[model samples]
Target: MSSAGSKPALVASSSAASKRQAANSPGGHVDKRGRTQSNDEDDDEGNDTQPVSTRAWLSPILPSRNELITSPDDLATLLATLPGAEARVPDPQLTITRARHSIDSLLDRSETEASITAALERFIEAVRERSTERSRYPIALLAALPGCGKTRMCLEVMDRIVPAFCSQRHIPSLCLFLNFNSDAASTWRSYEESARHPQHAIARRLLQSYYGGAEITTNRDISVNAALSLIRRTEARRQQVLEQRLHIFIAMDGATRLVGAHVAPQFQEPDHAGLSLEQANRRFWKQALTDLQVACRSFTTPTWMLVAGTMSSALKQAVTNSRFFVLPVPLSPLRAVYAARLLDIADPKAPSSRLLPWRVNSKLMARIDQAAGLPRTLLHIIDPTTFLDTRSSVSIDDATLERVVRDGVQGSIMQHDSDFLESEALLIYRKQAPVFHPDISRVERPTTAPANLVMAAMMSTLHKLQGPDPNKAFDLWQSWEAFCAIITNLRILSAIAAHPNSEYVQVTNLFPGSTSSRLPEFFVNASAWRDYSEDNPDRRNQPVDGRVCLTPAGYTGVDSWCTVYVKDNNGEYTPATLALQAKLDQVEDCVPLSTQIEYIEKAQLNCPSSTTIVALLTTARMDKFDPSDVPPNAFILPRQGYKEFVACFELIADNVWAYNPHLSSIPRLASQFYGKGTTLAQARAIAEVVNASQSLDPKKQFRTIRDLRTYLEKHARVPNSGFTIQSIPKDAVLGWPYADDLVMEDSSITR
Candidate 1:
């Protein structure tokens, strides 16, 4: 190849020009630019002189297409002719050995559990001894959830069984690994049409194990059937040659995909008109599995067929019917010791690294185990590369470890498939159910649909909910579950409300106490205001404490005028400042606290002269207060309440239903009562009653109380005694858990 554009032109000397001129004169003429011009007339007349370009003389000789360039010399010559090709040529040995080393490293890096190793060893020994009828074919099924290392386990088994058989029995084992999930076999099938044999591509992979890229005899074509037959024949002939058996181990990873593929409606034929689509799909999968089972049985030698994957119910049933010896190798979360070892293997310095002392702290190890013990989860939590930087001393303290654990758990939950969320959520609920319900079996468990819905809602909330603290995300999850539990019980009550004979009682009856009888407690000390008012009879000149206590109902007074206050941060001991109310729920231009303070100063009510501050408390998550918007001396606490406020309001709403026997039939009412087009006030009222009735069951009541307590402990700012129930926002109250006006109202409540 020409190197004209590949390199800069060199300056020529007079000595080089003379040599070029002398060399060109006999064969051809040289142009001024040092280009060789062939004498066409002389060449056509059969002249011995032949002309070659100056660039051609400098170019390396290349091998022809017909030449077999196997030697290093030939390869070098061929590569040299291509521009910049010499730079691209890697060490031949390294290039050839890379795949082999990678395969070995994969096996070496796999952290095998002792149980897995022992099971494989036992199975292999049984197959060797031919101790049972099942050992004749010796098919073992390994099942696990995804990312739980089923594939790695298969590799580990092969790594052990292959060597053991070879060393002890003096027999060579052929271990074939096929991953159906990844289409490992199908990928090679694409090349079969052009290959000399049906199994040519597969045989090539097989040959790599024995030869490691060294030239092998490939003139003879071998099909898959022929390869298996050859293995049987070779084993029979081994008696005469080495007196050893030829053990053929065929391991299929992701065997579940085989069933999944055939079960998929698109892959099944609809030729049978009598059969439904589902039936036809199942039949196709059954046949495919039967064929695989038969193929495994056909192997006559001491053969081992190992299938591993996330086994579905259908797949498991099919395997059992085939009479395969099922050796369950379930992958568990990695133990701390194994995780540490894996980390060490991934990064040799990880075990000693100060930054990631995962092994040093037992508490950290336990936390990691709880957070993500699976191989994939652990790796994701602290990737090998994360500890690669050695210049700076890195330390994973308790806080950092906690964050990592939280991140890993959150990621695992989020990454889980929606179809599996119900089961995962059930697992979480089961752990807590025993504690909350002593008679867990009797407690009505949530169905898959509701559980999945709750999980989805929680996930959506987590995605949108933002704050500075990472722990808040976890707290949100706890609060969400509590919310879900309460709603679930309420839904159960609605279903129960279909019956007319169900008794309805007051909210206080459940607690059975005079003190806890009321839905919400209100406390106020009016002595200061009363005493001040008596001293100055003129209302305009009297001092007010501004300490009036109001329940949710009291907040919306019969009169248009309402009193509100800004509490002093120093303590509730100092008198509160009176303020003007701008909005309740749906009023426009709801003035900010700062703007309201200005309004209070201008519209002074009948009160003694005193510095007043505007204090507004609502269920809304308010923006951070701007000091510039208010006076410097003003105390403004925004978003004072947590989600507990919503929970409390919901509880009060439930109480409305419990005390009002007439509303007991709300669940049976028509759509108009809770349907779309219903006003916010209407929806809130209906929802509270319906939900309260639903939550009246003894079990439900207990669950609600427990969930409420937990929610309060995590997110509530004040004790139950100090807190007052507030009304829910009109827009927020109409949902599935709450009553929508689209639902019919029961006129029976009026009775």
Candidate 2:
């Protein structure tokens, strides 16, 4: 029905509140007093789903969450106390902030000029090694996306590193905080410098100290040009002071004293203050480093200069290989890391479901991860007060995410909007788009799982079904209606789901045709109609059908595509070919063994037999599938297949009874997916692989699926319990009689 790939999913969940409040509250609690959340308390159990603003989440984290010092005033005191080689309160990497703060205070506390003067004598003990000795500080360049907090972190560090003096008599040493942007700080300019105006307030304050009798008045606005002249006069004075104090001259330009301008020189005097033409051109690149070198050589006191910026391509040229060593801040999967780092502070009792779950889960995460290598989306899904009860643990369940992403991207070139394509896009984009596809999400499933073989053995039914199940249209429709109601107040599915307090579904009701209702009147916004996309995408001609399909450029401003990545049996990830998966499945929704093998061969995949079995089983069950240029075993199997498939597994184990290869502990594999693992799961994957081959029996090969799943949920490096399935019905599965006898539970899925 759809094309091989599709658009990146939409990200509508703003969580502006989530981002703003995630940083502090006392002991990990969020301050919810004045916050106005989009979802109301009534839906705390089963109703409202709306996308909140980003400021809700961002503002909290962005504000200084200095775990070291409780309050801003206490910060200085805490910094002055750090002692010895190392002392880590919680996280070790931040040990430097404590040390820098503590040591600077000791310098400021000096009573006598002798103590200040002897501070240089203390340098011998601190400089244990030269910059060249250890490449360990390979320039801690923190590579991150915009607004990921690098700049804020630099400011926090500077606040610790640069000491502020308390005495009025003391002229503080210059501590520069530079933004790679080529503009100078406005505060750096002096007032009254421009010919037409008065000076700035701050400039007047500084002038009071510089000149005793200067009484600057308030209210008169200084023109920018006038301020520039005064700033230049002061700059000239500073230059003279520099010449007087440390005579070994450093040349600079008359234009930009900083890095943007080239150095300029006076032609008449051989000993002129200005730089020559040759030096002028390169000064923009060299002044900061040159100054640091001079400060290091001439001053006894530790001269700490904190320089930060967006990592422009000009870095290689801007930084040099001299006496200075740049420390690199290791880049991490920060987006993914945020779940463990933030969002736990949501209020549990405050009517709103304390945390927001990505409508998509790990499978979605993997898909997005593979396709775009970023978690991004366009719709901002907001979840509030979802009830974890009998029918559904959460009102907005995983099936919705599966449908949205898999359908959204798998059918990239679909002639229609509702087409579902087989794709690996959602997982790739999940992390980057925090709201739509979160860095982390809660796994939702039923309480009990089906019996011993096929899917039951693996216990990944719900998790697996959230991806490719062919008979999911009914559920998708049900959920889609529920979604529309939550976002648009239709309540169509809610009425069917036995909502006693809710009104019936009606067009006028969804909009109320008036302003009295609080719900977002969906139809009221006529812009919601698909009129804009009724044209063809080729851009030149209309489609054969009277309707036209718009290109990405025409419909949406950006183009979204999918990239395929594969994990071998050894679990190494590499870019894989974008082959259609359905062809491999043989059945449109299922990947058959032969086709999988053929594609694997073409892609040169060298995976173990177990992975092959899982992949084959997983493929045959998809609503839409394509052969990934991937190994047969990489795909996790659907839970419903556990019993019948495990029967095959049992048969395979019989043949390979004595053919013991040095297999990694199967319990270890299970432990990776969940936590605990039974001995039966040890050979489960291998058994599944062998069972997938024609010769193996079903039971022997599939016995340990449940154990494998349990282990996976508990101990894998990145525990992905999403593969564990639990909610599917007996009749819908392949081995009906067996499923019926050992079924866990049945609801709308049973029929």
- Estimated TM-score per prediction? 0.37, 0.28
Q: Cα RMSD (Å) per model?
A: 28.3, 27.1
Specify the highest-TM-score model's number: 1
Q: What is the lDDT of residue 383 in candidate 1?
A: 47
Q: Please give, for residues 576-677, the per-residue lDDT of candidate 2 as tens digits.
A: 221111111111123344554564353223221121111222213323334353343233233233222222111111111111111212332222222122
Off by over 4 Å in 2: 1-144, 156-285, 297-301, 321-323, 331-338, 346-579, 582-751
Question: Scored by CA lDDT, what does every candidate get?
Answer: 0.33, 0.24
Runs in model 1 lying further than 4 Å from the true structure: 1-132, 135-137, 181-224, 230-244, 263-292, 295-299, 344-371, 384-751
- Cα displacement (Å) at residue 744, model 2: 29
- Reference-based lDDT, residue 128, model 1: 62
Candidate 1 CA-lDDT value: 0.33
